[model samples]
Target: MGVNISKGFLLVLVGLFAYLSLLLVLPFSQYVLGAILIAYVLYPLQQRLEERVAPPIAAFALVGLAVAGFVVPLVVIVAAIASDARRLLEQVNTDSIQLGELERAIEEQTGQTVDLPSALADAAQNVGTMVLESSTEWFSAITHTLIGLGLAIFLLYYLLKDGSDLLTWMRELTPLPDDVQDDFYQELDEVMWAVLAGHVMIAIIQGTLAGLGLLATGVPNAAFWTAIMIILSLIPLIGSFMVWGPAVIYLFLIEEPLLAVALFVYSMIVVGLSDDYLRPILVDRYAELNPAVIILGVLGGVYAFGVMGLFYGPVVLGALIAVLDVMNDHYDRLADEPGMR
Candidate 1:
């Protein structure tokens, strides 16, 4: 009885500490967690390299390559997109002729005189003023982001270098029985594999199909839109729709009804089919999550944690389910044993 009480007290203390840490160290925790995730994704490659070379050297080389491979393309793509978006916004602001047709259409639809030219001028002025006022804030944000990136890289290096030792330490620290620890590790591995594989495959498929559709329909910024689709596809439900819906509406607004119809059909066939039909099959086969649970987990996670929440949210839910599953199995076995009842 005393031992049980002690264990309960320890559990409560641990929980309280965890809650406090989360509240106090959210920003630092985010960077560390992001680094850990990056390490998790790259660990397999690191392991393979270790088999071929010295472990230390292999880890260093693999982490370096992984960082470059992941970060460089991302930086380039984001910079390009930002440059293009700025240019687009600037062009839209400056080009007075572009608004003439839009104003006429609005006037025709509403049967009211719409002075769009004045509105556009006023908007441009407001944008300029806002940009000037916010320049310092933008620079500060960029500096913060750079600092976060550096911290993430440092965490990732240590994770790759000492991850095994850290796991061993965690195993020792966990209050659960040895059998439960093994089960927990196995379940966590399965969940990570399922999430990483399923989301990546779906993202690639959706991105490719969307890009192809846009290319076929002569949409501007096809690559940029496709990249956006890929990122958004990591979120469950309303994934492809967020990308294609606006494109369709824009095409229709631009008086390209036939092109809009083609885009809509193509998107339905490719994006809709893959998301509705293929994604569930792949995710279920690997993750073993209930469809309803996944939907709720994803939605709840997004609401709570934003983009990273999509990955971490489902992971937490799946981990809890795994723990419960192990407990249920153990209890059933105990019940079935002779004289236990």
Candidate 2:
């Protein structure tokens, strides 16, 4: 009786500590998860580098490359976009642009009065103001930003350098048989590749192609619209249409019907067809995710983890599917065993 009581008390203690530990880590969950994902993506590079250099040196080289190649360009692009948006708002507010012309055109077409200029001005102002405020707020929180960034860097380095040992440790801790664990790892590898290479790479290509179309059609602020298209392209069932669609309407409103028709045709033929053609070469060759899974994952992930959640959401869903598959196999094996029957 006493031994049983001690065991119960011990289990309670473990549970309490586990919950507390989770609470402590919850605030920095984004940084931790971001580091893990980035490390996983860069691991191949790390391996190649380590073949010629030490592990720590390889890890450092990769981190430095990421800072220069990814982080720096991202910061510059965002700053430029924000500046352009502000300028656009100013241009929209100016009387010389004849915003009334578009409103008149719309009213003439639909036989209904619409304050399109005021609505557009209000939207531009809000977007510009929001972006400027966000930039200011981010700069103001320098301490917190630095801390999160430093944590990501530190974690990233260790993961890149010691990922194999970490995998071994996890394998030891997992209670599953070796073959089941191997299957889980294999499924996970394919899914991650699908998310990164399949979804992300395809989005980039599609967005760039749409951007070129925008440029060819002589759309105003093509760079900014291109950036927006790239982001919208990340969402399943919604692609570059959100930006080009408005541009088409605007072109028609401005009496550029020829340009508008050209854009519409180009978008349908080039932009729309790209997915059908490229998806098989990129994603279908590896693993395919159901569109529903990706959609739900993206929505729920963004709600939970902000921008980073986009990648993490689908990954979580993929991991869940893998677990379910493994469980199904386990139960099948159990049913096949004859001792109980």
Candidate 3:
């Protein structure tokens, strides 16, 4: 008994050390999980291609396609924006573009002196403080972001190439009944598809459409505002309005009443309705998670994991609910047992 107690104590000690060791690399955990998700999403295409070609080649092709289809356009857009950014930065002192025209227009309409600069003095000071504070950290952030992206892609390639084997190995390590393991994974598969394909994809579509509408309607700084909308769209009930709401008001303030009305109508009809009608069909049809659960999860996930929390939050919450439902079914079956009674 003493020997057994000593062994158990050693095991606990080793487990504690292992947990502490994982904390050291906790920063990379998000990158690793992101890679896993990317691989899972693209696995179907890889499987189809693998039938005709090798798995490695199939993964390579898919990765290339992903880079070209998504990353390439983003890189092009950034490159185009960079030149404009450089010119803008160079002329920042001379231009005073932030509210120069808007302020002048407001002053003209009201026939009142608008000390917009003075009003924004606090904001400018905050910005200055932020720049001063983060000036040193920006390089570190950029480096981590770049490294995270590269690692995600690299890990994605391997996951896609050996996913089946990895799943098999994991199953072997699991102590649960084989059928129980299967059920868990099957439910996980459905939940992941619903979260990634239905909710997340639809949100992106809504954001893109909204951005196009903004651009077509001639909203200034459309790209910048569109990015904000995409991030806001992650919240189930509250979406893109946080960005475009101000834009609509700006148009009215600037005497572009017609443009303001058009933007407001577009936002109400297109951006507004898409989140309400489309997201549920995608999520509820499979995930069975109500908007309330999702909203709570989004709020909690953001609080816990930050930005990636958008995807992580919904997926984790949906998976939990799915697992619980499966457990209920298993319990229902067990209720028939005389011993259970």
Q: Which candidate achieves the best lDDT against the true structure?
A: 2
* Per-residue accuracy of model 1 over 1-341 as CA lDDT, tens digit each: 99999999999999999999888657666666678788898777777776788767767786688778888977977886787677688777555666778888988999988888798799999999999999999999889778877888877877877777888899777756667678778888788767666765677788779877887887777768888888777666657678888899989999999999999999998778877776567777665655456567677877776666667777778888887888786756645563331
Instruction: Write down the TM-score for model 1.
Output: 0.75
TM-score sort, best first? 2, 3, 1
The list of candidate 3 runs beyond 4 A from truth reads 1-21, 79-136, 280-285, 331-341
TM-score of each: 0.75, 0.78, 0.78
State which candidate, 1 or 3, has the greater TM-score. 3
Off by over 4 Å in 1: 1-24, 79-133, 275-285, 331-341
Q: lDDT score of model 3?
A: 0.79
Q: Write the per-residue lDDT of candidate 3 for residues 83-199, one digit (tens) a residue.
A: 657767777695656587887898889988777878789889999999999977998888998998888888889998998799889988775566667788889888888777666
Which stretches of model 2 miss by more than 4 angstroms? 1-10, 82-142, 332-341
